[model samples]
Target: MDVELKSLTGNGTWSVVSLPKDKKPVGCKWVYKIKRNPDGTVERFKARLVAKGFTQQEGVDFIDTFSPVAKLVTVKLLLALAATQKWSLTQMDVTNAFLHGDLEEEIYMSLPPGYTDTSSGSLPPRPVSSNDTAAEEALKILLRSHFKIKDLGPLKFFLGLEIARSSQGISVSQRKYCLELISDTGLIGSKPVTVPLDPNVSSHKETGPTLVDLTPYRALVGPHMKAAQRVVRYLKSNPGQGLFYSVNSDMQLKAFGDADWAQCPETRRSVSGFCVFLGSSLISWKAKKQHTVSRSSTEAEYRALANTTCCAPDKGGEKDCGADFSKGHDRFKSSERCLLLDGDDVAYTEWF
Candidate 1:
């Protein structure tokens, strides 16, 4: 591929018939990945030839690159709907998804080695003596061709989420991802904790000196985030993991809120959290820091409740109106078990 690319440039497939003055070509590199099945099986090898987007100037090379994605709530709602309606779930993936996007900007890239234009025949390594406009046009045309691309239809496995469908519903799991996470964290050999976090402890930010060795910290966090992404992948892995609506149950949306006071040592900021359930399924959850400083545990809990009341879906009634879940406070009743876990008890909440 590199050879063909080099030859194409020399023969005017990339540059003009003559060399252009002043224009510099951006570099590119080869990227590789191993596709895997959800069942911890090897699928196939994949490769990508990508431009060195890092080298491109922000404003000059590209602009307005933002893309919208479905919200987490939206995703959960869709899943619930699928489960309820018993919809058939199918996953399709576009091969070389990024390549399918058309380049709107006039971008010039360095010729990759081993790629050549067959129509240009053979050409000596002679400099192209041409104007910049002609050279740019030739380069663009060459880019459009020479690169052999194909789409690998459908998605069997993506981001470690294994998806399977049945008459009961769609099942989404990250058993493989979880294994990888356990391996990466060296937790496979370690005993499993009953919960991901300690309910008894709290965190706080310290003004102490920073650590000199940051590599280990970075490595730890990297896998942590990968695990979290795996959770999202699990949600997207199956379209059926969502809400399963039924006519038998009452349409009541219940939310629970909690907080850990002065969770962060450094900032002394509390961590507030909440989760909402539609029927028996968990539809939404959030763990975040409080905006203002809280004076006491009661105040922190009150703030968290207030935040949840505002954010959670309004199931308009006198029982759900009060913005507090104090001890012994009995406002709303639900026949189903509550899915909300106290945020302070979970170790993962500290990261939030």
Candidate 2:
């Protein structure tokens, strides 16, 4: 806690201020956590001062909220491209992520619990800069000037996913995360299952009996507690199982899409899914319920196709994304990649 407070104060994140008239201040508390390694050994202890942002009124305290974060799909795609190019992947951490951004609204936060300061603190705006790095030294010097940065050497564990690079390719898995999840549910000693869930047991929102004790059910799973447990058991069978991006990939894009029309009993909405492959390496994929109900299977399939096209890599950002395909038109600009729907009833038309 002392280290955390010192860092915050050193960064000049907030300054002592008196509460203004006709204004409400949000409270803050210290959050502690033990960060562990993949071997289940304690790596370090962390403490963070978190503001009770939930207490603030939406329109008054803040008009909009935005957090700059890289999507999982983007990570995978970058890894795939890096593996193909045989590029080195380095991991880095910002000393204080919260210090990088500036708050537009004039908001006040009460002093943390253990602090002796009686006056409230107002967060001051900070500057952020962007520049292209021509060399390694230039990049480091540029970053160090603006914020405190720490280099963790090579990429390994991030966001619960373990990463490994080899001559064959890079492999990513959630082995440690899987074990922790299983242990939390008290299923460490449970027998492993071949399947995640039984296909014969069809689940419906209105068909199942109401659970009298919702506490345990909600803790384990939203609706299907038993099925969710089985998924954990299946995960235990091969916790180290993960996706591999091969170095010998040909850098060709292949997409596959499918849909289940009227699968949801209550909403009658179609469930659609699609997966895109960059030369045998699966880069992006999603399975989601459609926003609106589709009357025919053809409509559902086309909707799935449309969703896949938008999510797939585009030529505009071809530097990071290897695939050279257009975003809006029904046809891809590159002849090598396309979303082709084959059926007599289906007509090829430009629809975003």
Candidate 3:
């Protein structure tokens, strides 16, 4: 507690100012969590002072909330390149990164324990952890010169994901996080399934009991929380399994896309998912519901293909063909360094 407070004070997060006549400063609370290692070991205990952002009125207390964050695809892309080039991937942590950044707009806080506005959901080494070893090192020095950062040494646990390095390649997983999720939802010792979603339980969703609680379904959560639990169970079964970027993996970029036509019972929107690979290294993948309903399967497939192509931006080089494609709502394409996809949206494979 003292350490956390000292760090906050040293960083100039907020000062104990005199209470104004009319200002009602927002209240703050301390949040705590236990960090664990990939092998189910306790890593460290963390405590954070957070303000009740819910109480603050938008456009009054704060104008706009824009958090600069990196997509998961970026992480996968870096991992893929590291695997192909056999580069050493290290992870660093900025204890209070958001507190250091210069905000565009100004906002004042009330008395008592003043609050520091948070930036994003989680930290995943955005603008860091790239393939270029020397460039990355240079960046580290520059960052150290500016902000107070701790070199954790070798990327191990990051944003709930566990990373392990070996002679063959680097492996990444979220086993610890999955188990915690299962425990949180009270699904311990439950039978695991092969897929993330259980088809039988989710089938015939025309009449399902509505969950009244709204907090549970914030993110990766829903009305029943069953889907989240099911995903946790699936992850439990393959706790140690994760992306394996091999040392011998080639740099050939390829992508695949597909979609489930009108699969959602509640929403008529079709589902699109896709995955991209560099040689044999799986770099990125996405699965999401379509915005609009497609009239025909071909139309849905084409939309998915267009999405894939857009995502598979050219990495400033020529790509060549690497994978075979099949008919009926499936597409493939490749970029110089990345591959693009749509509903059931993914891979459009034509190597430049």
Candidate 4:
């Protein structure tokens, strides 16, 4: 706590000032977390001071609530590219990163606990060139000059994903995350299951008695706590099973999309499912219920294809492949490049 206070004070995060008559300062709290290694060992304890921004009114307290974040697809794409290209990957964390940014709103925050001063709390890297050690060091020094950061060395575990690089390629998984989740759900001694959810229980079984109090099952699991436990058991069966971005893989981007018409009993909406691959590595996949209803199976399949096309962006010097269902939808037929395979026939379809 003292270390955090010193960092906040030394960085000039806030200046003591008299409270304005028309303003009600937001409260602040200290959050603590125990950082652990992949082996479930203690790495360090982290402390962060944050403001209760939820109490402030929108537009009046802040106009924009946007915060930059890397998309999961983008992250997966980067990992795939790095593995295929055999590029070096590193990870670093900026200490008090949120404190380095400047605020635009004239908002105030209550004094931090145990502090006598008045202040307000507000909430707020690019890739380096390859094989250039001197350039990387220079970039690190430049960043350190402006803000406090810790160079944690090579990337191993980040965002609950464990990354391991080998001569073959890169392996990404969430072994530790899965174990923690299983332990939290008291499924440590539970027998592992082959499938995530039991088909018989989900389809044939009647609805169980209503769970009036959902407090026990609310934290991590949902109302279907048994189903969640089944998933955990399945994860326990092969916890380390994850995507392997092989070095021998190519840069080709292939996508397969399909949909089931009227799959949902209540909504009668089609469920679209798609999986995108960068070479042999599965970079992205999703199964989502379509917003609107589709009249026919062909329409549902077309909607699924459209969703897949939006996710599969064109890359330079890379071929794009999409599953060729039928020619019911000519709207996607154009004079562009696309690898379409319908049965034994392999041809180029229009790329949108």
Candidate 5:
């Protein structure tokens, strides 16, 4: 595909622009990728010219780098909802996503190799004049006016989520990518474990001999995370998996939360976990460490419960007003209340 420059003003024309005196233009590079199907067939070849965003400065080049992304739970919930509602799910991709975002800051980027105006032919470099600020602003306006960008349209691929739409519902899968990761790590031939972690065992603060070679550990953790993410992909693989909703049940939203006290031996911080369900189907779940240190298991459980309770849409941020008790009794009371509310149908367990 050929890159065309359009006048930002909607009129067709090219304009010469000057560069800023203080700011250095970041470099750009072209990335190439080959799209393939699960059946080992080539789908298409794609190329993207991207800016080196890493080189950007925080205050000068840009601020507020935070970008909101749909959480994993959100993604899974959407999928489950689609399956339950029997609605079709489709996937589309925007060819160049970053290019669509309007540049907010006065940023300069290096001209792509072989795409620069070579006719300017080894022109002598000129020193910045006294009125450099005004010149820079005028230059930016001219550059934006000359280079017209085209939106590649809808999104077909995102991250690694492959989407497929059908009459039953939308299926998201990443079998191809998952298999590639498995193969890359030589884990394809390894035995498959039933659980992501060993429930009986716990990780403790190890003050003993440290790993002499950290490379292997980094490699191991890297692939493991990739596999966990691929769980979403596998779900997509079988878009028809058993997430269907039935008209026979009430759509009550329920949640189960628990915590392990002093779970991190080094930090003495508890690990909190919670799962939310719409009817019998789990819609959201989380397992994470508490930000603050808890004095006891009971306190940890209480804190975890508070965190889980906040997940409820109606519950605004409110401090727990219940009376306090001794460590043992408080923990028992917390667990008892949690179980009583959840009943035998739902399972929530906590231990220190």
Candidate 6:
């Protein structure tokens, strides 16, 4: 706790202050965690002094608060692209992520420096990683000169996702996370399934039951709980099974998607999912039920097709995703990529 306070003081997080006319000081507490390596071993002990931000009133302590969080999908997509490029992912400790956002809110620095001063904010710890050797080493030099920092080595357990590297490619899985979820829900002895969801389960459309004791685990409640349990059972069956991205320059992107029209009798909305591949390895995949209902099966298939075009570009930003198609998609400026629909309902006048 003493060390945490000293670090906060060193970072210029706050100053010794007296309570204002009707205001109170926010309380803080030290949080400890056992940081571990990728091989399920203890790496180090971490201590962080976090403020009780939840106790603050809306307009009393601050107006608004915003924290940036990285999505799991983006992480996998980047790893897939890295495998294709034959680049390894390494971790980097950044001093401040909200260097620009701190100017608007006074939640960071004790002293309000001039407009030119950019290093006043007390941004949260960023465990970001990169593949570029030059840029990463350059950043380390910059952080060392300004703040007291330490290197945590190669990327391991990040945001609850385990990363494994090899000569062939990188493998990512949520095995530990899945196990913890199963143990929390007391489903260790449950039977395994080949897939996550049951196709014949019609109760998914209606509210089955409410789990009064286990509401925090949303996946373990109501009709969703059964499907969630099935997913956990499947994870238990193949805990080591993960996305294996191989090193190759194929760069050819292939997309496959399907839609079940009016799949949910509860909502009448269609379900669509797509997986984009960079050569033989699958890079990204997502399943989502449409917000709006589709009248016809073709419309649902077309909606799924629309999602395929946007998935690679939105998720895989740094890569030359657009170049994969080359002249194959030249004529498809308005709505690019060829669409292949399943079943016999392949009737479209404008396209195909």
lDDT of 1 by residue, 158-199 (tens): 334454545565455555756665566454445444334444
lDDT (Cα atoms) of all candidates against the true structure = 0.49, 0.72, 0.64, 0.70, 0.50, 0.61
Query: In model 5, where is the ten-residue run with the lowest total lDDT?
Result: 119-128
Per-prediction TM-score to the true structure, in the order listed: 0.60, 0.82, 0.75, 0.82, 0.62, 0.75
What is the C-alpha lDDT profile of model 4 across 302-344, one tens digit per residue?
Answer: 7787787777645421322212222221123221222232232
Candidate 6 per-residue C-alpha lDDT over 204-299 given as tens digits, one digit per residue, 9 for 90 to 100: 535557668566456555346666667778887877677787876366556666677898788899988877766666767888888899998777
**Local error of candidate 5 at 155, Å?**
11
- Residue-wise C-alpha lDDT for candidate 2, range 208-310, written one tens digit per residue: 5677977766776534666777888999999999999999986766666767889887899998887887877988888899999998877787787778777
User: Per-residue error at 193 for model 1, in Å?
Assistant: 1.9
- Count clashing residue pairs per candidate: 34, 0, 32, 1, 11, 0
Runs off by more than 4 Å, candidate 4: 116-129, 199-206, 215-225, 314-352
Better of 5 and 6 by lDDT: 6
Query: Candidate order by lDDT, highest to lowest?
Result: 2, 4, 3, 6, 5, 1
Best lDDT goes to which candidate? Answer: 2
* Alpha carbon deviation, residue 62, candidate 3 (Å): 2.5
lDDT of 3 at 286: 77
Give the Å shift of residue 293 in candidate 2.
2.7
Question: Candidate 5, 64: how far from true, in Å?
Answer: 2.7
Candidate scoring better on lDDT of 1 and 2? 2
Please list the residue runs of candidate 6 whose C-alpha ends up more than 4 Å from where it truly belongs after superposition.
Answer: 38-45, 55-63, 95-136, 205-210, 216-223, 314-316, 319-352
Residue 41's lDDT in candidate 6: 76
| lDDT of model 2, residue 107 | 75
